[model samples]
Target: MWRDSFRLQIFCLLMAVLAIVVLVHNFFQLEHMDDDTISGSNWITENNVQHSLSQTTKTTRKPYCSYKQQTLSKREQAEQESLLAAILWPKPPDGKIAFVESTDPAHSDFVIVKPVRFFKVGDELEVLVRMKDFQGKPKQYGGDYLQARIHSPLLKAGATGRIVDCHNGLYKVFFTLLWPGEVKVSVSLVHPSEAIQVLLRLREERPDRVYFKSSFKSGKYSETTECNVCLPGDLPVCNFTDLYTGEPWFCYKPRKLSCASRISHAKGGYQKGLLTQEESLFFQSDVNIKRPILSSGPDSVIVKSKAFT
Candidate 1:
């Protein structure tokens, strides 16, 4: 009779433990449920808060500007603005040049000013370049970025040449003779003036041509959202700005995941179709971009000591 009573008590103890575990499990689920509901409702509340702050921007602008450590004065602003038109990046007055009107490196050529039989170290070599268009016509304006270099592959030596733009689509490249060997000179057109205009327009108007994205994860769930130095729209974001550097990095808020769940971030890709039909003609890989100009005379000059010179 005592054994039967002992067995019954053991069974009752087991049932009580199982009931407690089930109750605790349900409580945990309820807590997580509360988090989900709070997350949704708080997001809506934050959106309203953001809207109010934007509306009061004009009134708060003065204090905002004062909060900065340094502010530029009117004279300082004028001084910097005065330097906007640099001689280095001259823009020709004639606008709306078709692709055929752009500079063609293939038709363009450079020739040694005066070919010498032998060049000695410390001697200078001067080359003249004439720019031409696709239709084989001379250009009347200058704004092309040309890169010039002199190198001796056998000696494993190289030196950059100085270029002077003559504003009438004429360029002069000068190289100082440095090594005693066969020195080859090369001049390449880095960008046409037409492409420069398109690039400048993108820099100011479409600054967000290249975009970035970040991944947010929570337990088994994950999400991806666009990110950048500055994002468009009034969407909520996770302010993961660095405390020490004070560099601000913001990612658009994920729909379901929390801000704490962000794991990795990187540049996604460039925006497509940035250029118009006419602008697209300026950037052809096979045609003008980084094409080397043909040499009208000898591309390489023989340099030596007094004996071989």
Candidate 2:
């Protein structure tokens, strides 16, 4: 009975040793496959990345956070302030809104109200602009961004005109006749008020809409990944900031290459879906943006020389 008991004890010890070996083997296998798993997974979201802290002794990893933003990081706070700044920024519009992102430059018109038979260089010229929509309906409120200038191609002279918004869709442009002979007026809608709002949102929320990339090389091995001024989430990043100028830069960590291996950088591409469908309507190339308003009556006025005054 004693010999049988001793043999059973020896067998139990061997089984325990075998169990430990299997556990250690499985652990290393998981570690080996970790990078491949992360890379193959769709781990990124609109504003965050879902990734656990990688196991590495050479690099720092953020503590796993099940709850995001319990305490705002400096980046989070800065993002909040940027969004707040958009609301606090000063702008013109002490009136109501006629439409939302509907200013059509093609349907808009400007006219020379007081056309004089003869004008001298010392005189001031005035022009009236009326804002309209694609349907040709008059805009009742102000706040459309405009650029106005008076230029004489023959005289090779040009000057910007001062614009005054009446808070009602009408804008008055005043130009001082400086070396003018056949001075022509031009008015362009740089952006509609609602489109400006969309821009402000993009500035506050998705400043990294235009992304970039970088390449890392170690011996014959190379890896490339996207980069930006700042990246989202707790995913690992390589800091490439300029210490002397205090300029900050960062890039997404490569799967195989270390941060120290980064050698080259270049533009990636514009991030998709930065704007909503409604907001995208404001930025069509052939639409209202940077389009010129037609002259209703006369686009040019002749001015006499100062000596002729």
Candidate 3:
């Protein structure tokens, strides 16, 4: 009976050891499987993160590339404009002209004529004419023909002025006074500048012609007027706004009359194409209404025409 009991205890101990071994092996296998699962999940998460980063990089770079393209396009456009300006710019004027002065061949903003009021017989006189644009801006381009004349209405004496082109918009007029009694100096354009004419033709819709104001001393002045170019026998009246200033002017002309006649000083009156420098200043000034001048001296009577040439 003692032997049998010892054999039974040994069997029980062996079975318990076998069960513990099985449990330990199962635990190690489970741990290894869990580690593999964790590693695979981490790899998948890393791949997802890398893909997201790639997508983000692509999205951000697209705008950068587009901006670079836009910058290049603008630079090219500016270069093209510069090239066109250099190529298409008009050349200066040169030719033989009678009773016209072309001095310096360079352009200026204002004309200076000295000793305008008082003069003696055989006294040499100088007159300067400046070329400017419609906006009262100095014109750098030159190619205009100018002519000058000095005559007295009361006297039989008259003199012709010599013009020297400065190659700019400026011209110098040289004349010797033949008579001293109330001599009138008049300058007219022998020929319009090709460049300026082309510009005017291109901007034909605009009224760029300069006109003198009638009764400027009486505080009554008009600068611009509009004319219609309709079919024959149509209404002659028209209204238009100035392109540069947006100021409104009105005029009327019958089919029998020229369109130029529409720019008369007063209604149904003849118009003159002379704008004095002082009167031009009045136009260029910031003042809205035409202000009356206190005519105190002969300077008020000295008329200087301001033309584009």
Candidate 4:
């Protein structure tokens, strides 16, 4: 009787050990199956997020400026010639002389000539002009002559050419200090007959500083009464005070002027490009919410099953 009882006790102990082993193995296999399912779901979600972001980053067709030819009639040409003369040579009080050239390469006719009054030394001056074809349409010439000759003793002959690659119908001639005292600078325009004088001015210099106010509609446009200071053989530079924030900015080159303004405005979490609502949400989603299993050890299955169950 005692031997039988001992055998029964040993068999029961062995059965208990086998049952525990099988239960632990089954728990681990179930955990592995859940992990695989979760991993596949996470991969799908991540791939979707990346795909959405990429799609939003792509650029679609949009409206941009393009060049087009414009035509003008002969009667309109005469009226435009008259207007150009009046603007270029305004009157005695303005103190400037403007000469207009006909656009007809076949004919070199002086379309209009007028007298200007203002004159000063060491002053910054700007000559605004434009060129148009015989039909009075604004025309662009490959290379044009814009010359300024000072009659005073302090004057050194100076002229510059700006390439008219675009048909904007506007050109400017900028110069400074031909001579310090009372002086006169005669401005001339030469291009195939299509060129015309638009404006001439002896503008007073402002104080050393100026402020620029910018506004953004579809794009940006700025207004300021500032002059750029550039060293000889060095790149042009300008200092401008922001009208909106009253902050100061330095522009090392002309191309950077727009970029500087954009950067300044984009400081407070302002983004310029396209991003969809869903894409943005996905970017900000919390990855840990899915309860990712980062690592598993030999004892983790047994420990987790016992603790959670």
Candidate 5:
């Protein structure tokens, strides 16, 4: 019995020793795992802090915009006022003036007239005049009626007349000045009394070009005055006293003035006594300026004449 009890005590002591060894090993493993978790948590926190700092640095470097009050300078305000004045000013009733472009040799391209606007004393004014027809076609007239006139006190008195264009239609006249000053301009049309009036204040840097159109509704009639000029079946001829020369003149045989006749008349005076022979005058019966024969038909001739002064 004593020997059995001693064996049992020895077995119990060996089991206790094994249990203590296992418990020590487990405790060491648990400690190592805890250290790894702490390291991982520290790494994650460092990465989050670095990312937040990068975002903050980028935001600080970016540009920022905000609404602000705006204002104009004095010079800018003055310029705006000048432009507004020009826009609000009344335009000439007769339209604008333009240069005539024509191929006819008898017509003068530019009329010699005073500057359209007169600058202050000792100041030279430059004016540009352009003539355009009713159809808006450029450079069409080549005649004496279309011309430019400049009115000023220091310049020559009375209006200067010159042939500018022969084109039939509304004419546009443009005027400009080089210097600065207030000037009164009287725009006149030849033969036609209706003209345009314009008043302007010219400045050195603020040059202006004013516009006016000529009266197309006036001019002397070329046909007969007493009777209505009609072309029922054939062209009719008419005769009357020449307004300028008080001489007996005849529009040629075709009754209607030919292009050749117009060209001839525009070239100053034609040879008057060319047909002195008796036979020549007799043969030229159709060339005589006489009263036209009237037709009772519905197609009656209408006479167009200018109003006498």
Candidate 6:
């Protein structure tokens, strides 16, 4: 009886050893397939797969998270490889600006306007301008100088909007309503993706690029040049006049003369004259700017202008 009992005890020990070997084998197999399995499978290692082995290592693997890291790393590697390839590639087309991502409206994938419209006086208008490539996707980087403006011819009201660069092919425009009327918001790319400041300076310095004039086609037609003439600090713009006619022009009622220098100033010192001429002209026009209908929603009051770039 004693000999039989001893033999049984030896058999039981061998079985226990076999079970441990199987568990160890399974653990190593899981580790080997971790990279591939984690990505496609939502396998939680700690609670499920690793539950049996947790007591051995006292640590659990974040398989899915590790898989995500691997994916992002691979993407970054691919981007780097593409960049290297571009550098080694032959010269591109002549007209293309080097390293510049085009902001042409034709390439725009989509644009989002926040809140769609302003409801009342002093309401803020926000626009999100997304620049896309010919492939209809947001550009990877940003170096474009964008500008936005609000105009309402019927209300004779207008305001210059602010542009915020998000550095990811997205721009934000902010505007405040001075008069409640049907308004049209216009966004344009002032400069391409490269040498933005230099290009802007060139555009501003040359009258042919961005200058506006007031002229009449009657007998002995007269013409006048207008600029946003303002001094630094909060100085009042009192001594302003029409460049050609020498007639005194008051500041736009809403005030277009910026006390501070604009971020995108032209080549030289601020062009001297009525900087707010466009907005003021809209105000002076006979068009009666009025608030939009209430029931149709404020969005009915604001309209997006056609592509201007």
Ranking by TM-score: 1, 2, 6, 3, 4, 5
Ranking by lDDT: 1, 2, 6, 3, 4, 5
Q: Which tens-of-lDDT digit does each residue in 13-132 have in candidate 1? A: 999999999999999987775555424212222212111111111111122112234455798658657776443377767767888989999999999888988889889999999999
The stretch of ten residues in a row with the least summed lDDT in candidate 5 is 58-67
Per-residue lDDT tens digits for candidate 5, residues 141-171, read: 2222334443445433323323222234223
**Which of the two, 5 or 6, has more TM-score?**
6
Write down the TM-score for model 6: 0.33
Tens digit of lDDT per residue, candidate 6, span 119-191?
Answer: 5666677767777654555665666655567788777777897777677777777887666557766665544
**Residue-wise C-alpha lDDT for candidate 2, range 1-309, written one tens digit per residue:** 999999999999999999999999999976765534433123232233221132212222253322223466698789878988765532434322334427889889999988988789879999999998777887766768899999988768899999988867799999998885788999999998667777777876776888877666566445667776657777787766555543446677887777876666666778787877777777776786898998989899888888884
Decide which is better by lDDT, 4 or 6: 6
lDDT of each: 0.76, 0.73, 0.42, 0.32, 0.29, 0.44
Cα deviation at 47, candidate 3, in Å, is 99
Candidate No. with top lDDT: 1
Instruction: Give per-model TM-scores.
Output: 0.69, 0.62, 0.30, 0.21, 0.18, 0.33
Model 2, position 18, has a per-residue lDDT of: 100
lDDT of 4 by residue, 134-162 (tens): 35554343233434333443334343323
lDDT for model 3: 0.42
Worst 10 residues of 4 by lDDT: 295-304
Error of 6 at 266 (Å): 18
Question: Residue 204's C-alpha lDDT in candidate 6?
Answer: 44
Q: Model 3 off-target regions past 4 Å?
A: 1-90, 93-112, 195-309
